[model samples]
Target chain A: MNSFTPDRTSFEARLHKIGDERYHDKHPFHHLLHSGGCTPDQVRAWVINRYYYQSRIPMKDAAFLSRVTDPALRRSWRRRIEDHDGTEDGTGGIHRWLRLAEGVGLDPDYVSSARGVLPATRFAVDAYVRFVRDEPMLPAVASSLTELFAPKIHKDRIAGLLEHYEFANSDTISYFQHRLSEAPKDVAFGLEWVLDHAVTKADQDAAANALIFKTEVLWAQLDALYSAYVSPARIPPGAWQPGEGLLQ
Target chain B: MNSFTPDRTSFEARLHKIGDERYHDKHPFHHLLHSGGCTPDQVRAWVINRYYYQSRIPMKDAAFLSRVTDPALRRSWRRRIEDHDGTEDGTGGIHRWLRLAEGVGLDPDYVSSARGVLPATRFAVDAYVRFVRDEPMLPAVASSLTELFAPKIHKDRIAGLLEHYEFANSDTISYFQHRLSEAPKDVAFGLEWVLDHAVTKADQDAAANALIFKTEVLWAQLDALYSAYVSPARIPPGAWQPGEGLLQ
Candidate 1:
């Protein structure tokens, strides 16, 4: 290897370092949500905006799958779509997220409809879908490496929510429960694929940058939530106002 | 007409009302920018991020035109691409924007490369491109109606920049100056098209929402800029840092 190209172990460390420094787990909003510091309105805003992200997961996976040419890759990737969308409509990660929304007192239908998602959340999530759709396979696959960071967040969220919120339950927190299992399996494959493919220095750089971009995607969503509904609390025009999309 | 469907005059009034209420003109970032309250770093940040918006204009127009089956519409839309892209490189509104970048002591090439744009700016602008590329023709066309409110902002920008910033000059301010004439012509056609086509109340509502969506897109970018570089000033990872892209 050239002086510039790090060995595989080092490259792996770099990706993990990015997560350690930059993952949405580090975002203040997550700290608030996990610790139960969020008010009911704040929690509701989180559910509403987060549903936009959840709703797009399958779509993002589908966009990724649409671009994969290899049968093995397609078969493996197809599981992601199925996981979010489920074999039937009432199942899957998205439905679990809706259950959480309902548990938090939102109308599941309204949350599913995504009528009140913050524009920043939509923009951030849509950028992700497009990134997966349009970027080359390496970076696209590398972007999913953020999943490497997901399991810890899921654990924190489940434990924190259960301890603090009356709304938390096996049903309401099941989405994160499921992700605690699902993400590691998915990340194992994605990390292997990225690590195996990113042999050259330039390849490693692209992969690293893609992972950084994904973290921003995650971080920006929380930033939007925090900016709009937290500290300064300047909710932009057309976003969900408090009490607007509650269960009727 | 049914009671639900607004008359053309009122529909136009409704669009103007959305602009008055939600357009980026009212964004504090703009107020800071136009009134010369921004520091040199803020100006540079705006220049870098706004260039991403400018760079995408032609590609957005091309995406719009690729979907246009009608020859007259294609013919009309072609001007937008031409206006920004020019017949050759380094000649059009984009080039003029680069002049502004240089005037602000930034590297024109760096601005053109779009390496330093904020993630929020990219997400918001890319969402606009995708909206135009994918939405039904009405909302897609309606989204561009933000241009209807453009001339006044352009005029304010020109007058404000010239009066306040040392970097402001004829060459640097020409982009806004050019848009002074160009935007009116574009908006006249777009407004007429939306008014003529939105016959049903649902259609009017869709167009109005699309216009509102466009305003949000514009406002979100500034919100991002403000959030990152203004109030909380928490510059998201991978966005332009203040001193990195300066001209030598």
Candidate 2:
């Protein structure tokens, strides 16, 4: 077995390198969405499919929180659930995502129901939840490092959608705005925790791979969307169609 | 709360209805594979991806086994792990699946490594494992009721593969043949346990939904295969490509 352990700086660099190479922001579908190339129907499909990811984030965090035996770790992690689920009704990221769905002309109920999400999206999001639930604490924390790369994409998305689409507005895009502040705090703690915990080369490698796995999870969702809603349009049986589940 | 509890017979019928409506045997990809409409590469993809599902079966059972407090239940369930993992090396359903993989011209190591399987396949299979691990004992056992509908599909698969493909000899098809007897024994216990325990209306509904969830897990795998390898052929970024991992 190789035992070449890197210092903290190098290990952090490796983690960031994974995000640089593998993040979903680089996907062609994101390119289209950010550059104003996707149609309204395409945008709706993105919202519908992406809602699956948004809704599952709290579940993933909750699963992670359930596994933490340390009160300090649990305390730090429980905020994620709070951020996504909020303190009361009609608050938090999930509800905000539903607002985004409604702004894009989908029914909030349909988006929340997730009845029309792509199977690939569902599978990918569920995989993330399962990963956090099943993997060791260090690697599970490492996976959340995707948030380290999230703010830039959220900024790009806000700017792009606002410039390109009539439905885009401050109210509709509040989820991304909220995430901009929330993700940095989460990732700062998560990255420091991973760095502190992953002292060995094997731990570092596992942490790096966990981040890659998360990027793949995010990337695969977009790949499914682009395939189903874009050119050639071979939507699988029982995915959302263009006209289905739209707000009147 | 409404107290509309279906009796055992009706509940059994409801479970059968989920299978009738949502089973992957009803999927078009299965139709193609069974009837020899799949190209060799497609068959290879099926073998490669399906091997991930096969290899994880023992792990899923093991997770379930870990949570069982009843010795009799554990004894019955332990057989499932043994059946899939085998008494020693060069045995078990996993090994049999590898034989099928080799028969399909894939490298057994590659198939077992699962390095080249679809993300969706990985996700769906992992979801099943986590479901068994995390859900209540009743719902967890209820999910395995997919086996109740499995024997006939195995019989059909064995006959169809034997009739259609040159690689479909007795050894390669042994997995399904063994499953023909094993699934019935497993499901008999599972179904009876579920029927006995699920007394209230809510319990019955949860049990029925658990079965539906299992069917969805099975159906979604085929859906991923069909979308990636069939029709428009938008194979995701890192999935197994034809001729990528085949044996010499």
DockQ by candidate, in order: 0.01, 0.01
List, residue by residue over A1-248, the lDDT tens digit for candidate 1: 68889999999999999999999998999999999899999999999999888777766665665454332365566567657766554777888998999999999888877888999999999899889878999999999999998888888998899999999999998999999888998999999999899989999999999999999999999999999999799999999999897898
Please tell me what DockQ candidate 2 reaches: 0.01
In lDDT terms, how accurate is model 2?
0.84
- The 0-to-1 C-alpha lDDT of every candidate, in the order given, reads 0.85, 0.84
Model 2 misplaced regions, further than 4 Å: A1-3, B1-133, B137-248
Fill in the DockQ of model 1. Answer: 0.01
Candidate 1 residues B1-248, lDDT tens each? Answer: 68888799999999999999999999999999999999999999999998888877766665665455333465566567557756454567888998999999999878877887889999999898888778998898899999988989999999899999999999999999999989888888888899989999999999999999989889988999999998899999888888888999
A47-109, model 2: which lDDT tens digit per residue? 999888877776576566545533345446656766876656677788898899989889888
The residue pairs that clash in candidate 2, if any, are none
* lDDT for position A30 in model 2: 95
Candidate 2 to native Cα RMSD, angstroms: 19.2
